[model samples]
Target chain A: MEVAAFYGFSALAILAALFILFSKNLIYGAFALLLAFLGIAALFVLAGADFLGVAQIMIYVGGILVLLMFGIMLTQRASQQDGPSRHNRVEVPITRRLWGFAIGIGIVGVLAKIIFSANFRMSGDAVSRKSTIKTIGVELMTSHLLPFEIAAILLLVALIGAAYLALNRNPAQ
Target chain B: MSAISIYHYLIVAAILFATGLAVAITKRHFVGILLGIELMLNAVNLNLVAFSRYDSDRLSGQLFALFVMVVAAAEVTVALAIVLRVYGHFKTVDPDKLDELKR
Candidate 1:
């Protein structure tokens, strides 16, 4: 049952990613990204990172996706052309696509071989499986305290920078 | 049936990372490339969590994943803001066409 769920969610995530890649309309790609985010969250849960799973859904699905859709809508030109030219701008040149695929495939092949051949120490005991949330929380508050505080400061600075850059549309300002 | 191994998660992450790389490189629109970046970040997070689960007894991997998620959010926020500014000036987010910087 666990294995089935893992495969199912992994397939969903990959399919959504492919849809995002192939779709001409940016809107469709954004929506597909939502699905991909959800699928990854499910994968996180399956990996026993329950807290991270919820955080993924909340931050990615709830927050970042909304921002992406808004950006898409805001930047849409009000042109009245009926052809696919508007959407086709998202497509890459054929030569670039071919090169991209070649590189992508080669990298995947190499990484897959390395990963599959390597020996990973595994704890197959079900009894040892536990939620990592508490452990993460304790570590974050103690040993990882400095980085945790730094991340908060980074978020604050980013928030301010985004607001300043977005609100001041005029370059002269 | 064998339990889902760490290798399974690693393989999935590898696939996602590859697709993300392709998307990032090939997509003309800046937002599409941003989406690809997000996918790659997720792949890294998956690997981290999987390794934390299998290799380490501590929650270091999960902790690192959380930090990655925070950074990714910040990155997307700033990136989208820049994209909006670019659209305002160039009236387009297609990276190939934003060649004013080249001159």
Candidate 2:
């Protein structure tokens, strides 16, 4: 049962990622990313990182994906609106497409071979355990405190920078 | 049957990372590239979480994954804002056309 669930979610995530990469329409890709993120979150849960999985859903699916969709919708050219489906189509040069496939396949083959052959020492208690939310919270407040505070500050700075960069006021004015 | 190992998670992460690389390389849109980058970051997070779960006693991997998510969020925010700026200045977001910095 667990294995089946894992396969289901992983397949969903992988297929959605494929769509995100291969789809021509930007909006369609963005929508596909939603499913991909959800699948990853599920995988996180299956891996016993329950808190991180929820955080993934909240932060990624809730915040970042919305931001991406807005960016895609706003940046389209005027000429793009004349066509229905072609408006946000990706225009990859033929040479670049061939090169991308070659590099991608090569990396995947190498990495898969390495992964299949590598020996990983396993913790027997990893999967059967639950209540990871408490462990994560305790760790965040204790050993990970400094980095947690720093991440908060980093987020604030990024928020301010994003607002400044996206401002539309004319500098001459 | 044996239980799922770190190898399974690692394989998924590898596939995801490779796909992100492909998307980053082949896509013309700046936002598409950003999405690719997000995919790559998620793959790294998956590896971190998996290793933390399977190999370590502490929750260090999950902690690092949380940090990675925070960083990825910041990156996407700043990157999208820059993409918007690029569109405002050049009137187009095509990376190839925004070769003004080259010359």
Candidate 3:
């Protein structure tokens, strides 16, 4: 049963990702990315990282996706003559498209070969079924305290920097 | 009938990462590139979570993945603000059009 669920969610993620790659409409790609994020979150739960799964949803889906949508909407040109669908379309040259496609396929082939040949003889026990929130919380406060605090500082800097950058620096354009 | 193993998760991550790389490379718009980058970050986090499944003792993988998420969030916010600024100054978001760096 769990195996089936894993395959289902992984397939959902892969398919959604491919959809984003093929879709020319930026809005469509963003929406498909939302599906991909949900699928990954489900995989996190299936892999026994329950807390990570929840956080993934809240951060990636709730926070990041919304920010991306705003960026897309805010950056669009006001030229409505080309229709709504074409307004946000990305025109990639044929050669660049070929190169990107080849690179993507090559990387997938190399990584798959490496993964399949790896003799991963794990020394630890199999995945524990317990909720990871407690372990994560405890670790964040104890051994990983410094990095946790550093991440907090990093976020504060980002908030201030973004606000400052968005402000109008020059009055006369 | 074996269960879902690390290999399965790794394969999914590889595919997602590759697709994201392609998106980042081929997209001309700044926001489109950022979308691709977000996909790549998620793929890496998925891989980390899969490995952490085995090492349940310390969970260093999950901890690192959380930090990665935090960094990605910060990156996206700052990137969008920059994208907005560029669009305002240049009247175009295409990276190719902006040839003069100090115009």
Candidate 4:
């Protein structure tokens, strides 16, 4: 049953990722990415990392994707004339897609060879790690306190900066 | 082979990374490239969480993944704001025409 669930979630994750890659509409691609994030969270559950799974869903799917969609709506003018703009730009030659494909495949091949050669044994039962939320809180306050605080400050700065930038207007108008 | 292994996770990560690379290379929209970058970051986070699960390293990788997530959020917030401003000035976020910055 667990194996079946794992494969199922994994397939969903990969399918969503492919959608994100191939989708023509930007909003549709972002939605596909949300699905990919949720599918990955499910895979995290199958791997016994429940806390990480929940965090993945909360942060990536819930938070970041919403921000992405908001940005898309704010920036993209919903007009039929602008539709040809993106299509027109697509005709210009830049880097060859085949070169990118070759490089990506080469890097994956090397990494896979190295990873598969290593004898990795799964460790202690993660299911035994009860009260993960409590432990995470304790760790955040103690051993990880510096980074925790820094992350909070970073988030605050980002929020303030984003608002300031978005609200700034040209004086020459 | 009877069950999903760590290699399965690795393969998924690899495929995600590859697709992200493709998106980064082919997409003309700046936001599309940003999405590709987010995909790559997520792939790295997946690898970190997977290793943390399979190893007895005492949640170190998991902690790092959390930090990575926070950083990615900050990055996207700042980046999207910049994209909005760029669109305001240029009226488009297409990369090829961002030649004002090009030599």
Enumerate the candidates' DockQ scores in order.
0.65, 0.70, 0.77, 0.53
A121-157 in candidate 1: lDDT tens per residue?
A: 6554322266676778778888999999999999999
Instruction: Give the winner by DockQ: 2 or 3.
Output: 3
Per-residue lDDT over A94-163 for candidate 4, one digit per residue giving the tens place of the 0 to 100 score: 4656665677778778778878898876655434244345656667888999999999999999999998
How would you class the docking of model 4?
A: medium
Ranking by DockQ: 3, 2, 1, 4
Docking tier of model 3: it is medium
In model 3, the runs with Cα more than 4 Å from the true position are: A170-173, B101-103
Q: How accurate is candidate 1 locally (lDDT)?
A: 0.86
lDDT of 3 at B79: 94
The model with the greatest lDDT is 3
Off by over 4 Å in 2: A123-125, A171-173, B55-57
State the lDDT of candidate 1 residue by residue for B46-97, as single tens digits: 9998877653346778889999999999999999999999989888778898
Better of 2 and 3 by TM-score: 3
Measured with DockQ on alpha carbons, how good is candidate 1? 0.65
Provide the lowest-lDDT 10-residue window in model 3 chain B: B1-10
Query: By summed lDDT, which 10 consecutive residues of candidate 3 chain A come out lowest?
Result: A79-88
Q: For model 2, how does the per-residue alpha-carbon lDDT over B60-99 read when each residue is reduced to its tens digit?
A: 8888999999999999999999999888888887789878
In terms of lDDT, the poorest run of 10 residues in model 2 chain B is: B50-59
* Global lDDT of each candidate: 0.86, 0.88, 0.91, 0.76
